[model samples]
Target: MSESTNLREPHAQLVMAHGWLLRGRIWQPLQQQLEPQWSCWAPDLPGFGSAQRPPGLSPTLPAYGRWLAQEAKQRAAGVPLVLLGHSLGGSVVLHAAALLGDQLQGIVLLGCGGGVYQRRPFARLRQVGCALSWFQGDRRAARGLLLNSTQRRAVAGLPKLVSQLAMPSLWIGGGNDQVMQPVYVRHLAGYAPDHQIEVLPGAGHLPMRDQPAALAEVLIPWLQRLASPRS
Candidate 1:
């Protein structure tokens, strides 16, 4: 009954993807708010917090997207998964959805609005991130994550990701999020005609940490609507 198998499977309830350098636990609080009504699956992608980089694995954005598609498929036993991704994870799942096709019920991007970066700033930002990751270890795990995060290869696919998607897409941003503010979120929303935008007022970059209750309120209703028979 798995989506990965030859047989077409039923729709998945939901699956969550965390941002870069983070573990599956990132979705714990969110899960707590929505559980009993719905269950969530959060994977620790390779080279992130608790997950080690697999040997010889390509650490590019496209590679991560393909990997997440498989992971979501495995968890989606006969059901189209309602996919949610945070920051870098959001972008990753966008690419993942391209592969998932009808197996995905819908897509939600939290604090990650896709857009092309200004060349000079993006390069400098990438350099800074890589430097910090290099400071973390000699294995270069962090560096790879940072690279995929800010690379043009990732942004290059946004139009394609949006164009090919046929499901409802939601873009949620923190009102106070300096990293990906409303302007940035707005930019991301424009790319996908099917997307709905929600900015959590008074919430910062990590709304799950800064204002969990409010974040839950914003998220739960949309999910319920999705699960309803009317949807």
Candidate 2:
């Protein structure tokens, strides 16, 4: 379907928030897979993709979270909205879920941040490198920096806040993800014991890009189950 097609009107609205530095187009493959059953809205986060950065904001995760919350509130409008966020977008959805409360039906976190708090010293250097890349107008670099930063900030507090997240959640991880790592995924599983976890084989940091069909195969069923009437 064309980018202009409104995916929020008739079917269940699937809000697919992209990771840092990437545009909404990242979701195109998955969107195509879901087709008419799921209308996808993948909006660019502030300061990234096609979305403009808000004035005076630091373009940090918290700032993005607030902006996303407001947008979801306005656009969701009582619809059964399901949130699927990648990397930094994962962390954004977490904060948005907290802010939106009952308005959200479920959340899917793909190669998510906020899974582990501490990292090796080189990880810090990686972060520095990412920041430098952003200054050079490299969005992919900026995205990496954002994901790393979000993970660092949210990891410590995530367990506590996750307990308060009553929404049914799903965590998708790349088995070969060098960035987030399997240890982090294990930590996430322990934190949200009730939530489902799926690991994509042969996938990297961007599982949606690497394994769109695999991701969708896992995601669509969960969305449908969540949409079903509860006993």
Candidate 3:
């Protein structure tokens, strides 16, 4: 799923990961905007969309992180690689960062944060997510992802992962995002040693889809900085 146009040689590679009960196709709008400049691939994570989970792959965040890292390795084509994740996808990106090491240029997170575990809220989320997935995505994938969000290891490890990030990162939040409020986004950004946070005043959970140009306005400049030749 390389979505780059052949109009020009791409300067970098981007891998887009989607959130729970969502497929990679959700990134199409943003991919179109990035165009020939960025060689972008948005794969449906296993158990979501048309992808099937490998025989032994479990429905854990770490397992998905490994899969994402391998996917990026294959698609990198010796160019700078950046991972962009939305919501739950951001958690996956954090898990894969250390594994990608120096090959990873940077990371962009949208509507994703919160290492704190709220028991009742998480339990309610699992139930609501599972119910909604039956209509929007794979029931199995939704169940596993919802379960992962509630696990001690996944929730507790997020802050450490954010704090340990060696590469610079950008975290974006929607001012009206009820799903993951801007507060959580700022909260997590505080942990990273090198990070920038942006909030789109009119956007919500799915900014890439709802506000592509606005999202791009915040994204393109940061990407330019990353793609710049290091002295």
Which candidate number has the best lDDT? 3
Better structure of 2 and 3 per lDDT: 3
Candidate 2 global CA lDDT score: 0.72
lDDT of 1 by residue, 39-72 (tens): 6788787787667677766777778888888877
TM-score against truth, every candidate: 0.87, 0.83, 0.93
Stretches > 4 Å off in candidate 3: 1-7, 136-138
lDDT of each: 0.75, 0.72, 0.88
**10 residues in a row with least lDDT, candidate 1:** 3-12
Can you write out model 2's per-residue Cα lDDT over 151-184, one digit (the tens) per residue?
Answer: 5555677676566777889988888998777557
TM-score for predicted model 1 compared with the true structure: 0.87
Whose TM-score is greatest here? 3
RMSD of 2: 4.7
Off by over 4 Å in 1: 1-12, 135-139
Residue by residue across 1-231, what tens digits does model 3's lDDT show? Answer: 354443477667899999988889999899988987778899999988898888677888888899999889888967778999999999999888889878899999999989888888988888787778777445666688779877777887799999999999999999999999999999988899999999999899999899988999899899989977889
